[model samples]
Target: MSTIVIKRSQAVWQDRTRAYTAWVDGKAVGRLEHGASLSVPVGAGEHEVQMRIDWCTSPALSVSVPVGGTVELECGPNANALLALLYITLWRHRYIWLKPATTE
Candidate 1:
């Protein structure tokens, strides 16, 4: 088995109290809270992951995991307080961000 680990950031001013739904291969697996990390097990190979709340969702993140390997990802709302309105009204689907963790 392989693991998809997702770490969510803490956004004090944006959706701080809400939880994002974690999706793997288009199925809702669990709720990922702010500033929390979750691990979802999957068969080895490629998969698509997403984090979303209602109409707001991050771009899909594609990953390949070897047998017994792990893929780490980070996600959060892309909209800050100032950009929240714009994101809500314009790019609802891009309101969140999901990507491979490089900056840590």
Candidate 2:
């Protein structure tokens, strides 16, 4: 098996104290709080990763995990506190962002 590490940034003004649900290939594997992280184990191969909070969610991210290796990802609300309302109401799928940490 391989591991996928997902971290959530500390956004004091956005979803400050709640946890985001971590979904791997459509299954809820774990949760991530502001400024926190979680590790999920899965077979080493191609998979989809996403983050959700109620009906808000990040677009699915495609990933490939090498045998017995680990991959790291990071996520946070795509919009700041001021724009959160517009994000969830007008662009739910883009409310949060999930991508490889190296891409940040």
Candidate 3:
């Protein structure tokens, strides 16, 4: 089996108040709190993952994990204030941003 590590940081003070739910292949995996992370074991192959908070969600991300390998993901709020506001009111933009971690 492979592993997937999902993480989120309390980058913005406002975000510190909420924890996001991590999902893999449409199944709820666990909660990711600010500055915290979780690891889930899965069969080696492709999967779809995302994060959600309240009514907001991150775009589904497709990832492939090799046997005994790990895939890392990071979730956070948009940095742009204007876009952040839209994230609250527009479903299209109402999502946290999830991307591959830049560093291990």
Candidate 4:
């Protein structure tokens, strides 16, 4: 057995009003607030992960964890531009981006 640490932060300062829900294999694992994180223990194998806020959701992320290994993932709103925000809000589009968390 291994642990998959799903670390998520509301990196977008403007969208801190809502908390994003982290989903693993279609089940709600935990809720992530601004500058928050969650740790999930999973068996050694592949898993599906995603973040959802309102009607928008990030794309399914495929992750594989080795025995006794850990995987770090991050999620945040794509606040790079105004149009992107509009697309996310108006179109019910997903502007949240998920990626492997970088070690600082």
Candidate 5:
């Protein structure tokens, strides 16, 4: 098995709404906030790792972790874009769900 560590850096903006969902092959594995760290279990081999915020998704990182080793991911600037996209997407989803009831 392999271990993965995700690290987030602080943004200058006061916004704390930024949260990233970590995915493996389009499946969500876990989530972490900006400046937070999350550890995940992985298998040895080349794996596609992704981070998504709202509707925007980060470029998939091809990571190869050795057996019983660790891989550290530094989630940086792109976080802002990721977060913005996610917020808009979620808002749309919420509107779509809530509007139907009120309109009826």
Candidate 6:
């Protein structure tokens, strides 16, 4: 089972549109509109974590986690450093979250 823990520092729009997207291993996984918390089934093993909202110039941010491990990402409002943005974009954001690998 793969779970994503998100902590939002801002509120959704008045229309109740969060306009956020999460990607697991380069593939979009879950979409949260009016909600802040999201849980979804993720592929086990090492995978890339990416997320971004509207008005956000930069792409998704990432980190790395172990399999079967639950990772939490906090969304804060700020302009990241130039170098960081460039590096992150190369990896398509970051290298966050690690899902458990399945054994045959």
- Find the 10 residues in a row with the least total lDDT in model 2: 9-18
Residue pair clashes in candidate 4? none
Q: How well is each residue in 20-80 modelled by candidate 5, as lDDT tens digits?
A: 7777756898987867877889887777777666655556777787999887776644324
Which 10 consecutive residues of model 4 have the lowest summed lDDT?
Answer: 85-94
The ten-residue window of minimal lDDT in model 5 covers 95-104
Candidate 4 Cα misplacement greater than 4 A, ranges: 10-12, 89-93
Worst 10 residues of 3 by lDDT: 86-95
TM-score of 3: 0.88
TM-scores, all candidates, are 0.93, 0.93, 0.88, 0.83, 0.69, 0.50
lDDT of 1 by residue, 1-104 (tens): 89999999888778888999999999998898889999999999999999999888888888998899999999999998678888887888789999998863
lDDT of 3 by residue, 65-92 (tens): 9999999988887635656667776753
Stretches > 4 Å off in candidate 2: none
Candidate 2, after superposition: displacement of residue 64 in Å? 0.2
Sort the predicted structures by TM-score, highest score first: 2, 1, 3, 4, 5, 6
Candidate 1 segments whose C-alpha is farther than 4 A from its true place: none
Alpha-carbon local distance difference test for all models: 0.90, 0.92, 0.84, 0.79, 0.62, 0.49
Model 4's alpha-carbon lDDT is: 0.79
Pick the winner on TM-score between candidates 2 and 4. 2
Model 2, residue 54: C-alpha shift (Å)? 0.9
RMSD of each: 1.3, 1.6, 1.8, 2.2, 12.8, 8.7
Give the lDDT of residue 84 in candidate 4: 63
Give the number of the best model, judged by lDDT.
2
Model 2 per-residue lDDT tens digits across residues 27-101: 999989889999999999999999999999999999999999999999998887688788989899999988899
